[model samples]
Target: MFNYHTLYAELLSSLHGSPLEKWLPLLPEQINQGLCEQRFGDLADWRQVLQQLPEVSANKIELKDKIQIDGDSSDNTRAQIKNLLQALIPWRKGPFFIHGTHIDTEWRSDWKWDRVLPHLAPLENRTILDVGCGSGYHCWRMLGEGASRIIGIDPSPRFVVQFYAVKHFIQGGYHGVPPVDVLPIGIEAVPQNLQAFDTTFSMGVFYHRRAPMDHLRELKATLRQGGQLVLETLLIEGGLGEVLVPEGRYAKMNNVWFLPTADTMISWMRKCGFKNPRLVDSATTTLQEQRQTEWMTYHSLEQFLDPADHRKTIEGHPAPLRGVFVAEV
Candidate 1:
């Protein structure tokens, strides 16, 4: 059996005696269910990849500027590390450097981080929840910013294993477990009205939820009073009350349901009882920001867009214009 006893224990241990202690009873089952082989046929293969990772100790770890692990390693060992990591292809949210190998992922998640970081309240000693945090790239960055604890959740089993693959090097290099983890679950698994975290991040997720209001409420429920909510999602340019409800697919993504204007999103946040809601940054995603790479050999933003007109998606909807919003509950 593919067991994650240590991972589960770490999460439960961190929540023990904390405000999130109530979550303990529910997590073990959820984690097991999320990783069940019947649910993810490739689970065994992914687990094997994790086990195959070269036993390398990082001499230096840098996450403040980028996800990098530098260790005195020979060329052969670096090549071995690269091969093991390649099994988890389509890496969407990182540009991690391990030893001498650069796993340049599809998205330059660091660029997005740069835009969102300046607007965030100081992360020092904060407890954070990152929703849809694929592979926990930004979770490490949050820890780098001095967060006391961080739990990033995503449903993809592939992403879960990818996170642990990186964690293998990170934890192996250190004396103790870092206060960061990625759970193989979704936001729905989170206890309602837990009000536990100091800050909650729901990036690139709002538009996918069929019920945007419910999603907003769920995000708010995770935070304690006066806690901050940082959200980033696709948007259209329009006034309040205007939203783009895609009839079919948008940007080759079928799950996308709603793309609201910045004003509309703020209004939605207000309706969910969030206070002081405001747009912090807005920018269109570019080919340079997300594209096919050696590590992520899959079609990306360029293929999703209209080749003749970069302003629109192939399906004729407006191209991805993302907005970052911050509010307090």
Candidate 2:
């Protein structure tokens, strides 16, 4: 019984009479459909857990150096906060400091942010969209960097709940911050040709698509003319025109369709009508960046790689090498 209607109305109110007002009429239905379809079996239980969180005011909210929520809370209350967050296991994209508790997620998503931040157009006062934003972690960082507003889309119900949990603290404590919201939807759910955002980010998502060109086109459609596109995905070392369509699972990740070389990825971007595609940063994902943590106890990148050859996955595909590219729509 999460009041999505109220949430939708709030979103509409925030956007009313703005440039994004065109989305108001259709957004409620789209969000409702997405919420219904993506409902997890344990969604009710998750919502209950969210309700169980102790009410505490975050007197100091920090997002510049790290995502931290600081306030005066007794140790017992801090323990309660920690236990409540632990229920949302498999936290995959953050290292959020809530009160006196630290929820260390599987991926050091901050590393990825650092890599992509330097090469992009300034986010200040821009309407930003984050495709496949897990738990809205990067969206918070985008807000920290001075974005006017940000909307993140992810299909995972757990992620949506986790985002709301964090947002609860922020909104309860720090009022008057710029608007940010995470929709329970996929990239495909985005209305085609909306063309509303100043910057659109598709990170760690392109390779997961069955049809990557279509994915690129979808990313393109979300941006206005001359807007920036930040693309980050897995890549392999090879010359131009070469790409790897994983024979099966790559690094134990199913549904990973393609990993193109840097040169080839630039070519694909150009073909999709993106201008001045430039390879910005490329790095191999390391255990330090993604590994099992107390909050995310599941097996991670270390377990997926080959013991015999670290350069290859356990399934013998090339190991995880990521590339970041920036292009213009």
Candidate 3:
């Protein structure tokens, strides 16, 4: 099995020259600034003798409740896609990915590049909106995958600029890729008049909202009765079907709230007017098992932070969510 931690470092190392390079270079420099002190790089040679570091636990968020998702017995593709998304999860939280691959710098022949292609749903001929479109990786992927018109929305000015930078490198203009238009805005920015989208996908975003019901209602308000919404967020195992974040702030990372369970999510979706809302796919069977046993190439938000920032996890949530939700309006 590939050492997930090592593989992540290697993958990130290869992304050194991309947009993400800005943040990582400092990490190595700080370690070696005074004399040869810091110790982290190199594909092998993990021990060339360097400064010793304090002990740390990978666990960042406190589990108010254990995560549990209703696994689809037949969708093996879910696992594959989760592996693809696993590479991006670490970037969603603090100390974001400061390497290029997060925004599609080099090519990955076997993984995520074309993996989401098959699930594109021939959306090219239809209208689609991608919310919380950080770096616009998936937004760009949708265009190439066949989305006739695509709107990429995000509230991060930096992320928006970076997304455009990458898109410009590929398509030459930000005006509109003939049918693809990327807007740097929040989910609430989607006009109520544009009430229907053939499909909508929001990843790592739903949980940011503390009021799951309100979030669902807004999503439903944006979708036409027949439109489809695909949501992916954290879920606790066999726990509270509906979790209320009375004490937690939605604005945890950015200015957004955090939610709890997927069941809580599904309940909100149903309350929002979506019928036949289904948990068609998911990868984390048990949060504890996956966190403690998996020898996979990935990490949680905590792995990417320094001690000062690491202690802040006590105020947040950590439920494994690296998949999709297929819902109909």
Higher-scoring candidate on lDDT, 2 or 3: 2
Q: How displaced is residue 216 in candidate 2, in Å?
A: 0.9
Q: Which regions of candidate 2 fall more than 4 Å away from where they truly are?
A: 37-39
Q: Model 1, residue 48: displacement in angstroms?
A: 0.4
Residues 187-227 of candidate 1: C-alpha lDDT, one tens digit per residue: 99999999999999999999999999999999999999999
lDDT of 2 by residue, 131-243 (tens): 99989899999988989889999998889888888887776577754488888889988878888899999998999999989999999999999999999999999999999
Displacement of the residue 251 alpha carbon in candidate 1, Å = 0.5
Any idea what lDDT model 2 has? 0.88
Model 2 alpha-carbon miss at residue 75, Å: 1.7
Q: How does candidate 1 score on lDDT?
A: 0.92
| Model 3 stretches astray by more than 4 angstroms | 1-120, 172-178, 240-258, 285-319
Displacement of residue 37 (Cα, Å) in model 1 is 1.3
lDDT values of the candidates?
Answer: 0.92, 0.88, 0.46
Which candidate leads the pack in TM-score?
Answer: 1
lDDT of 3: 0.46
Whose lDDT is greatest here? 1
Q: What is the full ranking by lDDT, best candidate first? A: 1, 2, 3
On residues 112-132, what C-alpha lDDT tens digit does candidate 3 reach at each position?
A: 323333454466466677787
Q: What is the lDDT of residue 23 in candidate 2?
A: 74
TM-score of each: 0.98, 0.96, 0.54
